[model samples]
Target: MSSHLQAHAAELAHGFSLCELAEGLGHLDMDGADDVLIMGICDDSRHAKPGYAMLCLPRAEGRASEFAESARELGATAIISVGIPVDTQLPSLHLDSMGQAGTLLRRMFKTEQAGAHLYGITGTDGKTSVTWMLREALSRYQQQPVWSTGTLGLMRSSDDIRDIGNTTPSLLTMHAMLAEACREHVHSVVSEISSHGIAQSRIAGLDFRTAIWTSMGHDHLQDHGGYGPYLAIKAGFVCDCGSHGGNVIANADHADIRERAPASSRWYGHGLSRDDVDMGWEQELPGMLRLRSRGEEVVIEDIPLGDFHAENVACVALILMVSQDIGLQELPELLSGITAPPGRMQDVLAGYGQVFIDYAHTPEALERCLRAARKLARNRLIVAFGCGGERDREKRPQMGEIAVEFADAVWITSDNPRGELPAVIASEIEFGMQKPYRAEVHLQLDRDKAIGEAVAALAEGDILVIAGKGHEAYMEVCGRRMPWSDAEAAEKYLRRKNSGTGLVSEGEDICA
Candidate 1:
């Protein structure tokens, strides 16, 4: 697919540019006179001058050997980084990091394409859900080419969804993705914007036609440390957006959200508190909700169910309302007609209870998903969760606390504890639990068994939450990523349990 797209893209320098601020560095370099122009700038692409080659790195596409090969394929020029890498052999100028470099590219590349719009959702929690809901809602309007980019990757179930790397693609990659979307005749794109994406300047120059702010909860504390810095970085995206002045959807119930947003810009808030709102909803169930907005009230008889999803529903609905492009009331009827995103809060009916899948690796995300499971559970809530290796370890215990709060029995299973001892990682997570825990915490580093046990333990009324790894289908161990998926494991376990076929693997499934 990339090859086809590459063919259409104009030939440029084989070397990649460093910063948007460095765009046309070729023009200044006498040595680069013969170099193919690969414009690497620390600015917006819209502002980017014409060049032979351009680079958007530190993106979802990731810096890989293939990416390096792609760079080398260009005519000729320079090689660079967000900052300088040690023992590198290319003309390079160091900056802070790749994220910043991507941001500079976003600033330089001005996507002036007509009718092509982008929606970015950023928050510790609700990012994946919001991104999906928006894409689904917008797709109702056939005229709106609603392409979605999330944990599932860019594109949807039927579409060619490929990996870009980070949950949120880098600014340059985003611009390039938008460029591709434009070339492919898309009208709009929905992207999940994580705090890491924002902090690293990945979304730098890209202009979001509309931005959705899902509820903020404690996440990335190790990277963000305190809530203040985290909130500030996440909110900065909406506040400083672009010159076009896009809509900002926020949750008024959150003090940090309202406080973090710029006081000057017009804002819309939605929640249980409905004195005044662009849109509001009353939770009927986890997935089902009743929505009221613009003098119209509609009962969302069925959607996906989860305690945290109601806010996500309102987010997508409000954006639909503001866009005025689709019949907002018509959404409830579509699910019987449409499909669901792969992992975000997916349910599996098997084992001891109902097993669920979500891409919540952060503390806040775990809390939100668990709370949703609690709300939806007719009985006890059992969570199978784990922390990723080499990530912010601060949230591990907090995640344990969330499970301890909602689940009658919580299984500490490895999500993607890459390179780290699964037991050590689980231990840190145990710190957050309070006394006389509601749930019996068990460490099962083997994710498949963690899921199988959680499911097997359930007895009708229990709710099983498989968090951390959502749409993701692999697990990283000792620096090697292996084929692992929570959803698949849940499905396989349930499939086996329902058929009474495969015996549950004990220690084989869980970490020691």
Candidate 2:
């Protein structure tokens, strides 16, 4: 499938003058010639073409004007920047902020999504799973092409999902994707909106027809500055959806979202005892999720996944019910046999106790995955997890605490130690554990050896969960990234153990 909508550069760049673009920012200095006509807007100097207006965004290296010479050489007609003076004679529009300029440019170039309904989901967890399930169910139920973009990148159908770099891409790329979806006549476009994406104004101009709140946690505190700002940014999107007369699906279990969600917003929770909620999962059975709301009940028993997916599946039902007017009773059959996204509670090895792989990088996510794995395990539960380097360090210890609190044994190992030393990162995680539980914790720098240790010790009826690097295909150590797969490693270890092979290979006992 084509990555973007086919639109002539001149056609997409038409109908915007420099003065209107400057005025859109409001109260910005309209330096240079105001009458200069702009055919297109570009943030990167490398993508600048003749008649294109470039945004000189500030960066760590230098001000936006640092790239003005190159942008001018590439036929940029004008420069839009914040506090950067271009050396060229080309007209420049100076703003108080480059983010504001980016927002304005997105608004100018955004295509009209004529027939597509837009759904924006934001949270610390379940954004990817919920969006993926939503797209799958909507496409099958409505019989129209449905598009989704999030942590799994852009997925139009089962065959079209791939990474587009960022969880929520740059505004230019987002608009271009929507334009293509519109041209293909897709029915709905579901996007996973991250806290950073919203904080950076990446989805500035698009009007979402519905928005869903998954769950919030302490992750991304460093990026948003603190938990208060982080929570507010996620809530801001829910508030925006509600005020715009669009449907808002709020998680009734989360107090922050429950209170701020609009009066007309639909809610989903695990319990039916809540009097105020519109929909909820009334019963929890073995390998089944039963939901009830408004005297209507639906039971989905065909799911091969865990209990953690109960809420995500319910969120999909609520979205379809509100946006497509589908009945609650019909949801069970529609979602029958739906599969979880890659690395999300995915069962990689099933014999002699299952080995589940998940992208549970956050404390809340890890806790949920472990608790769900605990329910499935008939005996002991062994968990292997690690913290990513250069991320929110505060959560590292917290995650360590959660792993010990829920699982019978925990294997702490390297998870993309990036620039930080693997041993140093593991030590921080160990800090979160209590003295009594520290005996159960084992630190392994080599991920393959870690999985081998955890998997080899698992007896029949015992479950193993490898967390932190779910769905990822590579490992980042120091500054180099090498091809790696947690699921593949676990399977290989299980195969070797089952064949009566030793857990540790020759010359691979660094953890010994």
Q: Which candidate is the best by lDDT?
A: 2
Could you tell me the lDDT of residue 12 within candidate 1? 21
Please give each candidate's TM-score: 0.79, 0.90
TM-score of 1: 0.79
Measured on C-alpha atoms, candidate 1 has an lDDT of 0.64
Model 2 weakest lDDT span, ten residues long = 2-11
* lDDT (10s digit) by residue, model 1, range 1-512: 21111111322213343343465322122243344445433222223234433343444234433433344444223433444232223334444555455444433443454367778788777777777767776666554557877666776434556776677765556666776676677887888988888787666556687777777777676787677788888878878763357777776667788778655433345454565566677776544777776667777756666656766776676677665555656757643222346677776552343778877777767777777777767888888888877787777777778787767787887766767888898788877777666667777777777788777776777778787777776787887888876777787877777787764655432222
Model 1 stretches with alpha carbons more than 4 Å out: 1-27, 31-75, 78-110, 242-244, 264-273, 325-340, 349-353, 505-512
lDDT of each: 0.64, 0.79
| Residue range 427-452, candidate 2, lDDT tens digits | 88888887777336677778898898
lDDT of 2: 0.79
Clashing pairs for model 2 are none
All candidates: CA RMSD (Å): 6.2, 3.5
